[model samples]
Target chain A: MTTDLTDSILYLDAVSVSFDGFKALNDLSFVVGRGELRAIIGPNGAGKTTMMDVVTGKTRPDKGAVVFDGSVDLTTQDESAIASLGIGRKFQKPTVFDYQTVEDNLLLAVEGPRTAFSSLFGWRSKVTAYQIYEALSIIRLGDLKYRLAGSLSHGQKQWLEIGMLLAQNPKLLLVDEPVAGMTDAETEETARLLTSIAGEHAVVVVEHDMSFVRALDCKVTCLHEGTVLAEGTIDSVSANDRVIDVYLGR
Target chain B: MIKFLFHRFDKTAAYFIAALAVLGVLIPILNLALPEASTFHIPTYLVSLWGKYLAYALLALALDLVWGYCGILSLGHGAFFALGGYAMGMYLMRQIGSRGVYADPILPDFMVFLNWKELPITWYFFDHFVYAIAMVILVPSLLALIFGWFAFRSRVTGVYLSIITQSLTYALLLAFFRNDMGFGGNNGLTDFKDILGFSIQAPTTRAILFSITALMLALGFIVARAMVASRFGQVLASIRDAESRTRFLGYRVENYKLMVFVVSAAMAGIAGALYVPQVGIINPSEFAPANSIEAVIWVAVGGRGTLIGAAIGAVLVNFAKTWLTGTFPDFWLYGLGALFIGVTLFLPKGIIGTLTARFNSGGKGDTA
Candidate 1:
């Protein structure tokens, strides 16, 4: 629990955020090492999503330090700025550019100059094309690359969203409920995909499915009342009396 | 350039440009080269009227760029158009020197009538055609940049943005109506004598202006098409569909919106500049919010996102308005309202969108 903030790719120290009278995050602190994968499990209102929002700059923490890549303060940056700083986030619900082709969605997310001027003159370069193809293959969406994202099935859309993150090639990825509406087989495939992505980028996956968490086979953090209640291996965290009483309902 | 053109213009766009080109050359030839006795001859008055429609077409195209592609739904687009017209009108007013009814070389007739001792500083350098031309592009673009910066940065969107844009044009309408504003007050800028030393009422001038209007519409179409076809356009489409997703992808959404908004305003300004010379007047009525709403209708009826369709809708609607007003002036408003309701209920995609969808589906069925 006492990790060096400078040694981690993402360091969140004593972050707290409140909405009106409700505390979404209460003195939450955690460190994600470079290329490490962490699974967050909690009941409703445990602030798992709020923690992502704070780190991704969607919401400002009332008090805490969010440092990315060691020295960059994420609190002062906006969503686009934070994204450009090599932090990518996938929403709980699949959100893709519905009208655009799957390939164009990945193309838009591909790392490069994000200014209007650059986009105006942008053409598909060899490297970008290669990256897109690589992402498409990884997500098993290569054949549906030309199809409209809206037309894809729910699982396919989820994969396309993951593919978009891969195309971005961020140093850290925040994936929220990637398999929420997916089939069991699709969920297994997604677990495999996230495992493969872990060594190249730090991943913070927030999920509700214990089976899915076990499938990820990564370090588990159980949050309750806006703070971490347990942290250890999945077996240990699930075995904790407080985590089971509050979340598992044994 | 040839490769660029081929890549940018789809078949429909190519045909749209070709039609404009043919009309640009043919209409002038029919008016100027043929005698009035010949059936082929296009009367001077009709030429000017159609020229006005082409100008409206360009305005509608400008609106479509922001509303259809970017989902900005600007209801005050006429403000930019009217500003461009006023810029051209100021030059025309200056051109009337020594030839006006007041015959004042230093002041326009309206300024002289109001007994202004000196020309307003705003009117300075408007005497030069080059300055006026620069104002035509600059004035609207400047307004759009300032307006879009505030609106987009604040993330004002949907019907709320539409309401503000409507208020923007309405505010301009009121300001332009004030005589102290020195823009000819409620009467607006009129009494033009010439442009570039040619008689404004001359048939040759009318034909040339008509040709220019057609060319400008073609140019506007080409420019809009190029923007929407580029990766920039794809980003705009994404912003329209999923704005937050686009932001998460690292694009400065406000910057993209502002860029297109400014470009679209400039195009609308050019359309207004072309309109004034042919219409022989520029007035505060041009700034009426209703005028902007009608332009949006033209885009919607033709197909909101299709550049060619915007032009087609503008001409079609205006042509109908002319005929209906002449026959049943009292019923024109009702007719327009009914038409809009009918299009929304039966053809939500507008004329071009529905037709293209049908054609595409039919093609797919044949393959299947």
Candidate 2:
């Protein structure tokens, strides 16, 4: 069946990716509407991350179309090109520039010229400074702006990574396990942050934390063996018998 | 432009430049003005030797630009250095002009010795100083651009990239050693008589070369400092720390790597060009992989990411080499190996890195 791509910010239709005969993403058809917030849950090796990979152009699917912003094909672009097309990703592990100051990390993410020459000749202008300041306050790390990113605590780094994504100001954000090792309070805060971010940008969050997903309070997609098993409200997807059998487990 | 260049100047950079300027002026005076019998008189030989050290320091600084901040461990940087040196060497060879044993005005003595009746096409513009200088910069940059383009685009990184760079220098070493390659074969280019109408052996000339070397090192240091201090530098450090994340941030990782790689090569080339005049030779041996690796060791010995540290490391290590080789030539290689091992073991951050960390007292140290 043909999928409608006109309205969705991201439309993945029957995308298949395999590695060494192992199907990482098998016929994974998913759509994220503009300004939509999505929570993807699955067991280990269930292709949730792989689906994000396919969307972000990190991995090229063996078959089917990966469209972005209604008509732009994502499959043909490299990661940087895809990112430049307004898709930002935060990895499962917090990957902040450790040696740089927290302020500099945010500065790098603030949208502007990404060319080497531009950067060499560029100065930190008022707009970038303001953007960084805003991001720092939002991430609650304003006081530690000058501190090295490596010195930040684990939770702070994750927030910093999220802040980096926000600074990027992409049309779509693919966050992977943002609250993986966070405390309950931090997890809730992250859920709030992701929720707050959704209305302006389509967000695809790959998460294993059920409570966090529930807290997201958005559309939920449960995957098993590379394809979508169930997708609906968190309550409905969690209640699905097959989702329970393969992911939630008895 | 001045403000942009000096924006990153910390106390260390200030001190480094101040010390360089003082030495640049003072050493030349002491050497040129002092009588031979005076105890304070610096010898011409010593002047040239120190000039050699300054050139080395520049090369190390170049390497640090790529390896330290960019995380590009180029083990073949000496190829660029040698290429620049050869360019300069060819100019020097042209200047010999009938002064050689063979008395061939158009060809160098080595070419005449090899019975080459005419100057090769590669030697076309060596007679012109501007052309030679341009070639010195262009050749290495072109090689770097081509080499970095393929390697970075293919995402060849880490030790694999390092290995390929090593092979690159090794390949150049073999090629330059060939008799027909027109670079004077394994004997390389030497026996210079004049540079810019001045006798190369003149004490005044030696002093001038030494001063110029110091000036170039300062220029290199400032340019490097400015680069690392800019927003572009932050991106490079990011790429160094996390390549994939930088890409995810929409940076063309290969493009960044390629740009820095080319710039670094050009710097190395300039260093080599300055070096050939001071040292009076440019041989295939300069293209040796070991030399590039040694340059890297100099950066590591000082501090990899720290610009001043790289310069300090180059001078300090070469100083040690000069002293040790003069005193105990047999054990110099072993000492170098041990020095590298010890630095890696105890001071992984290098001298400046460790010192800055200590002085920062747990505060943010310079240039993470």
DockQ of each: 0.64, 0.70
lDDT of 1 by residue, B1-368 (tens): 44443575668887888999999999999999999899999999999999999999999999999999999999999999999999999999999999888888979989889999899999999999999999999999999999999999999999999999999999999999999999999999887889999999999999989999999999888888878988889999999999988998888999999999999999999999999999999999999999999999999999989887888999999999999999999999999999899989998999999898889888875211
Backbone Cα, N, C clashes tallied per candidate: 0, 0
Q: Please report, as a residue range, the 10-residue window in candidate 2 chain A with the lowest summed lDDT.
A: A121-130
> In candidate 2, what are the lDDT values of residues B242-349, reduced to their tens digit?
999999999999998999999999999999999999999999999999999999999999999998889999999999999999999998999999999999999999
For residue A112, model 2's alpha carbon misses the true position, in angstroms, by 1.4
Docking class of 1: medium
**lDDT of every model, 2 decimals:** 0.92, 0.92
**Candidate 2: C-alpha lDDT:** 0.92
TM-score of chain A of each: 0.97, 0.97
